[model samples]
Target: MKKHNFSAGPSILPQEVFEKSAQAILDFNGSGLSILEISHRSKDFVAVMDEARALVLELMGLTGKGYHAIFLGGGASLEFARVPYNLLKEGGKAAYLDTGTWAAAAIKEAKFFGQTEVIASSKADNYSYIPKGYTIPADADYFHYTSNNTIFGTQMQQFPDTDVPLVCDMSSDIFSRQLDFSKFGIIYAGAQKNMGPAGATLLVIKEELLGKTGRAIPSMLDYKQHIDKESMYNTPPVFAVYTSYLTLQWLKNNGGIAAAEAKNNAKAELLYNEIDRNPLFVGTAKTEDRSKMNVCFLLKDEAHTEQFDKLWKAAGISGLPGHRSVGGYRASIYNAMPIESVQVLVDAMQELEKSIQ
Candidate 1:
């Protein structure tokens, strides 16, 4: 039976992407060698890296003028340190918009490299909304924002335009939307959520923005270093890159970023509408700031929480449990999930309502 999976990360991918990738794993491009066996320097692997980078550029509407698309290791956690290290010079500061756990973590990492000014934070309301009306320091190296808060289910509906380079952690919603790439200087995201599986990060940086801090950053941490080496100085994550390639190709063939954004909005609408209509449920995030990718809601009667979960699990719906820190369910509708899968969850909610508590 095809089960509905709503886990936040390492979430659902297009079935076609998985099947094609599985075939390639057995015999990559008819080389008579499993994809796992190929060396990173091989011509076949180089093509995969190039295509993955190209697809990212194409989908994000980057015309290769200023942006350098790169696939790097160490995920967004590593970028937390690297972002400030590469940008913040001696006596310079970077502004961070603290929304939730990941944004708070980014601030913690940025502090190690240089001063990080917390210009705006949503902590007053337990991170239920995105902060607003804070002054960005004019002398700061860059302004950092987390585009989507996966844990808290809030998102920045609109970004503030500034002269300083705009840095963003788009981990949960990179290819799922459309935006003007020129407005962003650096954008990084861990691939597990929307791009593909984990083990790698995709960074789109403005080429001109590098070498400004004037510090000898370690080779790996430096964006310029990866750009110069073509993301192949060391053996890259072969399978992850290939899977990302498949996912990007799938995105391109299936109406690109614009279509994905529409589908994502629809999914969020379907779930949120049900949450509002049902008196027994309450949404966690505010309406204007709720994330299209992660929809968090709670049952009004806490007594029925366990019963609500048990019913869904028995019906082949899994991973609807909310994060421990936040009680309730989080339905993470990423790029690969179809509207039909969302309908199943909505239908399950209706069925649960029809049945006795």
Candidate 2:
């Protein structure tokens, strides 16, 4: 049986990417050496790094536009500190919009570096909807936000227009949709979701945004240093970076972000339509703010949980359970998930609803 992967992070990637990456692990680039054992500084590996960085910029339409793309070892969690470290000026305020768990985590780290004001939050209602009409202070050095709330299944459809620089953590939805890359001064995302495997984080930074904080950053955490080194400040995560490069190549071959967004929207719509029509289910996120990547819902009749769980499991669906903080189901339909897998889940849902009735 084919498992329809819906786990949030470290989620599904294209099968072709997996096959190519696996072959590289055995004999990379026809060099008879495994990618896992290769030198990061070798010409072969360096080409991988160069192409990966270039593809990242190209995919986001940031090439030749003062944006520098690089891969780093620490996941977006480390970026929670690095972002504020590089952007938030000493004693200056940074405005943050708290929408979910990850957004709150980003805010917590920002406070350690400088004053952070939470301009708005949806936590009061269990993060059911994205907050709107919030005031971003003019005096803020920058405005930071998470584009999509993976845990809550709510995504910000519109961004704030402000004089201050805009920063984003697109960990769950990067490359899964069309975005105006010019709007953000910095964008960071873990490669585990919508990109590739775990172990690397992708950062695209605006050159002018650095050195404004005036705080002396340690060499390791300095974005400028990484950019200067061409993302090879130290030995990088070789395997993860290579796999991500292959995944980006796949994205380009499959028609880039516009194609991915169209497919993602179609998959989300298929599952969400079932969630709304199935008498036994109820969507957790607000209809208008629903995420195109993570579709969260629940059994309206908790008594039918066991039957529905078994039905989906028997149908080869996986990772439909919601986070512990939010008791429900969350189907993370990312760029690589096929419409056929979505149809399977939707069919299982309809079957369960009919069986229960």
Candidate 3:
């Protein structure tokens, strides 16, 4: 059976990316060596790295705007520490907006470096909504927030207007929609979502933001060092970076972020509309703060759980179960998820209602 994948991370990618990556694994760039065996220092791989970094900036409309894009080895979790290490000066404060598990994790990391202030949070409400009307400390080194919450099903529809260097962890929603990319001092995301497989994280930093932390940073965690070396600081994640390059090429060919946003919005609408209209279901997140990338909802009656689960599974829907923290179902409609797949989930929901009635 053809499966409609909805796993949150290391998730679905464009079909062409899979095909091309597989071919490269067998014979990379027409060379006898697989992409896996090829040296990261090779001319071919260097070109791949160069183009991937450039494409990140180009696709986000940040090219030549004093922004540098680098693909790093650790997941965004590593960045939770590196971000404050490089940006937060000793005894200086950093501001954060807590909306989900990952955001809280970042705050935890930031606290180690200096004073970390949570300007706003929705944790008291089980993180079902985005907090607003919070004040960012102007004296803080930077302001950080997660753009989308994959586990909780909430996304920031609008960003806060702040002069404090804006830092964002966009792991779940990067490249899914359009935004003013220039406003952010830093933006980072794990490659598993819209980019590629796991093993790589993309970080786009404004050049001027680096080298100001009065404390000495280990070379591995220094953004300036990586940028100076042109993202070839270490061996790098060869396969992950190349596959991410292929995905970005795919995005550029398909009319870039604007086009992807259109598809993403359509997919979310299809699923959320069914969740709202169907008497058998109820959405978990606040109506106004619902994520376009991850739509979470629950059956109205727990008695129908077994039936609903079977219906979606029978319809070839995989990864339909929500995170353990938020039980029920979560349909992650990322940039690459087709509207047709979302319809399958909606149909399953409708089927459950009819059968139960």
Candidate 4:
């Protein structure tokens, strides 16, 4: 049976990315060597790294705008610490908005460096909605927030208008939609969700934001060091960087972020409409805050769990279960997920309602 994938991370990628990545693994660029064996400093891999960084800035519309893009190891979790380490000065404050797991994790790390203030949060409501009307301390070094909450199925539809440097973790939603990329001082994302695979993380930083923290940042955690070395500060994740480059090429060929946003919006509407219309189902996140990337919902009656599970699975669906923290189902329709696959899940929902009636 043909499978429809909906896993949240290390998740679905363009079919061409899989094919090309596999080809590179066997005989990278016809160089007679596996991508796994290439030297990070080799000419071929260097080209890959260069193009990937440039493509990231291009796709984000940040090129020639004093922004630098770098692919790093240690995933985005590492960035939770590195961000504050390089940006928050000793005894200076940092501001954050806690909307989900990752945002809270970032706040924890920032606190270690200096005073970390959570100016707004939806944690009291189980992170089902985005907090509003919060004040960002103007004297703080930066303000950080997560763009999408994969586990809780919530997304921020708009960003705060603050003169404070805007730092965002766009892990699950990066490149899936269009945005004013210049508005952010820093944007970081784990590659597993929408960019590529799990081994690499992408960080785009405004050059001027660095060298202002007034603390001795470890070379590994310093963004300026990586930028100075052109993202080759140390050995990089070669395979992940190449695959991410391929994915970025794919995005550009398909009309860039504008086109991807349209498809993503369509997929979310199809699933959310069914969840709201189906008498046997209900959505988990607030209707206004529902994520376009991850659609989380549940059966109106717990008695129907087994039946719904069987229906989706039997129809060749996989990764339909929600995160343990938010039980029920989550259909992650990322940039690469076709509308046709969404229809399949919607059909399963309709089938459940029919049987229950």
Q: Among these predicted structures, which one has the highest lDDT? A: 3
lDDT of 1 by residue, 162-263 (tens): 898899999998888888878998999999999788898889999888888868888878888899888887778888888989999999999999999999
Ranking by lDDT: 3, 4, 2, 1
**Distance from true position, residue 218, model 3, in Å?**
0.5
- On the 0 to 100 scale, the lDDT of residue 178 in model 3 is 97
Quote model 1's TM-score: 0.98
Candidate 2 versus the native: TM-score? 0.99
TM-score of 4: 0.99
Pull out the clashing pairs in model 2: none
Error of 4 at 181 (Å): 0.6
TM-score of each: 0.98, 0.99, 0.99, 0.99
Each model's lDDT? 0.88, 0.92, 0.94, 0.93
Give the residue spans of candidate 3 off by over 4 A: none
Q: What is the C-alpha RMSD of each candidate to the true structure, in Å?
A: 1.1, 0.8, 0.6, 0.7
- Range of the 10 consecutive residues with the lowest summed lDDT in candidate 3: 348-357
Question: Candidate 1: misplaced stretches above 4 Å?
Answer: none
